[model samples]
Target: MEKKKINVAISGLNNVDSPGPGIPVIRALRESKLYDVTIIGLSYDSYEPGLYMEGMTDITYQIPFPSAGQEALLNRLSYIQQHYPIQVLIPNFDAELFNFIKLADRLKKEMGIHTFLPTVEQFEERHKANLPEWGRKYNIAVPRSQMIHSVYEIANLHHSYTYPLVIKGKYYEAGIAYNHDQAVGHFNKISAKWGLPIIVQEFLKGTEVNVTAIGDGKGNMIGAVPMRKQVITDKGKAWAGITLEDSTLLDFAAHLFKETHWKGPCELEMIRTAEGKLYIIELNPRFPAWVYLAVGAGQNHPEAIVSMALGETVTPFTTYESGKMFIRYSWDLICDLKSFEVISTRGELKL
Candidate 1:
């Protein structure tokens, strides 16, 4: 009997410089016996994990942007189809998702690749902070916010909200603000740079908890993992994290999925005030930084997503290894470049 081969590919795997949340997604795909994975991305430089993947996967392709163009994307998809014939395509970053949406028709009809993404209107609605209005309709706690289409609009809406506002750009840029002045400053700078509409939000002070999960698009929950962050860096990356099982958060997350009809894996950042009110801050339509911690805990989110995409039954995973601690944004490695004699005799470096 021939072993069944499952071809899986992920986008946005370019080098590690500001590597997106796809790293763990790819790792899960590669490790799982469910599918043989092929990772794809564009990068100017090569690094550790990518280097390792280059040697392991069935295929690795680097297509430089603009130069890669629509033709190049189609060509790569075609070539991969010629060889491995991918069953599902997982887009990891905003740019790739945008491109996939643009070329989704061709990929579907011509190459027969399944791309998982929200509707264009859904993307735009959430992209421009319109989703929060939906959340508000459902009585979900969305911070008091304003949206600006131009720099001139900013002046009209400047004083409407209180201090420490979060100015966000369409789609991907959700970088926050600490004060009204800072919000305006960032709005002006980002507006000048990107020339996109900005959404200004009232900064909420509270404890941050991330709810990461997979949904079946029909208000059915596949798996949900909540994490309480211990240390978050200035760069907005988690450092020293732990997973928590909270039913209240799960209930809230189910409410969100029912409201949005969200499909696939997404991470929502929520804040809890001293009054114990939980407010939805923002949602990333992909995996989170500490997702590997959940993978380590036994959720197997990527595999669950893959199985769902393949029209397989995805059972709920309840027995997650609790009290799992993790450290992100930093790695400590032993220096094997020196001999023990050089270490002991020269400087007496402690282990």
Candidate 2:
């Protein structure tokens, strides 16, 4: 009997000093024992390395960014479905998840591109600006954060919050501002790119830890892996990390899923202070760049995500080996101009 091959599409392949989850997600899928997989790389930029990586993506297509609106993205995917049917789409960007979540039903019914994503409400509640309230409801501790619409709001922050506060953009960028000037600087810069209501969070001096996990949307946690950043880039992204044996962290992630009934992939950014209190910082709606670490630790989260999207019953993954680690590095892949021109001109490249 011929094994059935499934087509899976993944996005967020911009792997530079700052990485994307697309390439790692594809790698996890290809490692699956349950299915023969054909990887379809969906990228926003032609220069994204995953599109040109030699053997990884069997086919590649450039789609409009979420800023282009759901209609444009749907049109692009609809066109792709005509040529090659896509069974599942695992979006890897937090900025892009809203559009995908909105179109999950349209894609599944009209185009048969099934996606496992959180509901719109679930996505909204997990935003950095809303994290405090969400945590209050879920019984998780979150740093005090206030949404500021103007840069002037930074000057008076000292009255309510102390110095060395954390400045955050709604969609991206987080920095510790030691003074009012730095706070305004981050507010201006991040707001210029991502737009705001900028968020100013109370700084908690703590060890940073993160959990990459997936949920069944019925309060069931399929897979969970906790890791602490051993090395960090200037951007505060993890460059090297190791899995930890932290039952508290695992329980924290499970509580989030149970309270929200979260569906699909997510990353829980946390802070553990001197007193051993864990504070929920940010909830990313999609997989993180370090997601491959979960695969190496024995969870295969991305593969399980695809299986769930296809309506297959996946037992919850209760245990994964500890002491696993990941070190991220960049390499230049040599690619000819022809492949670039093909995707640039036609918006897709097929092998």
Candidate 3:
């Protein structure tokens, strides 16, 4: 049987030490049984490795940074559309999601592009700065966290938080600070990268587990897969993970989607204490870099989201194989300097 052809565009191709979800998401899409995908890789930097990986992208275009605002983004997409006629766009960065979420309607109405993303209210409320209030509203247990714009707030954090607290950026990057000086150092570092209003959260002693799931605009979870990190990098990225048959974690993610009616792919970062209490540490509004694990375990969250974006109904996945493990590794791709020069200078490359 012939597959339906789709022009799908995706961003967040920076697969580095601290990777992005683009490569994994694209891999899932490539394996889709329902569609023949033409992958358009949207990138913010020329150095993003996925731009050069063989068989990864049909074409790649450099896009303006999120700081350039939605108008600039729309213009770029408009230019790309003239060439590829994008039918579905999946944006994977936390910082850029706000712009994409805001433009979802315009992209669809004007350019015939469809995106399955969270509503602006859903995006704003689940922000790290707003997680405390969001937890209370949804009855989800979240750690005590305070958003601060200045380094001076680190001193006052002692009043509410103890040592070994977690310091996180507004969009990404996080660190465990064992003392005041470390906290100051992390604040300066993360703030410089992701900008101010860093969040200081009470550190929970527990094992870190993650859930990657998708929802269909309504209060229905299409699929969810829970995984335990088997290997972690210094940057806190999961280098390896194994799928688990944990009902409590699955129930927690289901409840969250039911309450918020999340409309797209999301990753729930949770910590389970020795006594079995679970606390949500972070809620990523998009798929994680390890999302391919879900596909390997039988969930295929990216495929489900793409199906939903194309106005197809996806049946909820009830079971996935436990003990399915994914170990991430690196490879050296030998590409000539000319390939790099063309993409760097022209801001687009056709592979």
Best by lDDT: 3
Q: Which order, best to worst by lDDT?
A: 3, 2, 1
Model 1, global lDDT: 0.66
TM-score of 3: 0.97
Candidate lDDT values, in order: 0.66, 0.90, 0.92
Tens digit of per-residue lDDT, candidate 2, span 52-104: 88778899999998889999999999888988889999998888888999999
Per-model TM-score versus the true fold: 0.81, 0.97, 0.97
lDDT of candidate 3 over 33-117, digit per residue (tens): 8889999999999889999999999999999999999999999999999998999999999989999999999999999999999
Clashing pairs in 3: none
Q: Which stretches of model 2 miss by more than 4 angstroms?
A: 1-3
Model 1: per-residue Cα lDDT over 89-170, one tens digit each: 7776665555666776778778877665665554555554674675666667777776777666655564576555677776
Taking all chains together, the TM-score of candidate 2 against the true structure is 0.97
Span of 10 residues, lowest total lDDT, candidate 1: 342-351
Error of 3 at 124 (Å): 0.8
